[model samples]
Target chain A: GIQVEQSPPDLILQEGANSTLRCNFSDSVNNLQWFHQNPWGQLINLFYIPSGTKQNGRLSATTVATERYSLLYISSSQTTDSGVYFCAVGSNYQLIWGAGTKLIIKP
Target chain B: SAVISQKPSRDICQRGTSLTIQCQVDSQVTMMFWYRQQPGQSLTLIATANQGSEATYESGFVIDKFPISRPNLTFSTLTVSNMSPEDSSIYLCSVVPGTGAYEQYFGPGTRLTVT
Candidate 1:
């Protein structure tokens, strides 16, 4: 089984600030995904970047497969972004998950 | 992207009872998984449900405790048997819709509390 680790266990930002979250994996993965679990406990898909970079709205993610690491960027953060962010990697039908970074955005 | 749904969004039960959570996917899928997430904790895979055969249980899970059934490609059920206070957690179902993308979609999850 692979190991997934997320940095910055907790973060706090102003309503319009920006922040970055990092995820490191111990082994190569065939699939990598970023998810946002909002206040209502819904797991929203942020990105499915196994490699390269992708952007959606005020959020973007980059996965360096060769380096076994991924980064997620939240720009101009809003109060709505106050939740937990998760990184999961999958290989051979098994998905390994990071503990997650809990974010708080003060309005 | 696939639409996934779970039944009984939340429930409270007695310690010795059992609860069955249902997962339904709008589209056909090749792989379905069951996961448990404790309060304020990360998700842990319980088992991988195969369509016609027995499920593959993870290290800490056993079939007698958390039995799973995938009768077809679009639906599955996970039963929390002989529930205890330690079994209180959110149960979620996920699917990988073999579209060559390797992306997994999750259901909203069933929040269970054992008294």
Candidate 2:
């Protein structure tokens, strides 16, 4: 089983501020995904980036497999972006999830 | 990506009773998984449901307690038997559209509260 670690267990920022969340995995992974759990406890898929960089709206993610690390950037954050962000990695089929980063964007 | 719908979005059950959560996918999926999330905790894989076969349960979970049925590729059910307060958690159903990757899309979880 692979171990996943996320940095900054808790984060707080102003509505227009920027932040970066990092995830590190102990072993090589074939699949990697970022998920945002909203206030209502709904899990929303943010990105499915096994490698390379991807951007969606004001949020972007980059996964460096060689470094066994992934970074999620939030720029000009909005209040709606407040929630728990989870990064998961899997090798064959089973996925190992990080504890998640709790982000709070003050309005 | 496939859209997944779950029945009984929330429920409060009594001890010794069982609750069956149903998961329906808009499209056929190659794999379906059941995960449990405790309050303020991360998701834990309970089992993997395969069509026309018995589900494969993860360590610490048993089929007798969390029975699963995957009659088809688009639908599955997970039943929590002899419920207790400890069984209260969010149960989520997820699926991978096709093979080659393990990226999964999750359903709006069923929030259960057992007394």
lDDT of 1 at B22: 99
Candidate 1 - chain A - TM: 0.97
Question: Which 10-residue window in model 2 chain A sums to the lowest lDDT?
Answer: A88-97
Which segments of candidate 2 are over 4 A away from where they belong? none
Best by lDDT: 2
Alpha-carbon runs more than 4 Å astray in model 1: none
- The alpha-carbon deviation from the true structure for residue A87 of candidate 2, after best TM-score superposition, in angstroms, is 0.2
lDDT of 2 by residue, A8-78 (tens): 89999999999999999999887899999998889999999989999999999999998999999999999
For DockQ, the strongest prediction is: 2
Tens digit of lDDT per residue, candidate 1, span B31-101? 89999999989999999999998999999899999999999999999999999999999999999899566
Candidate 1 C-alpha error for residue A92, in Å = 3.2
Each prediction's TM-score versus the true structure? 0.97, 0.98
User: Model 2 in CAPRI terms: which quality?
Assistant: high
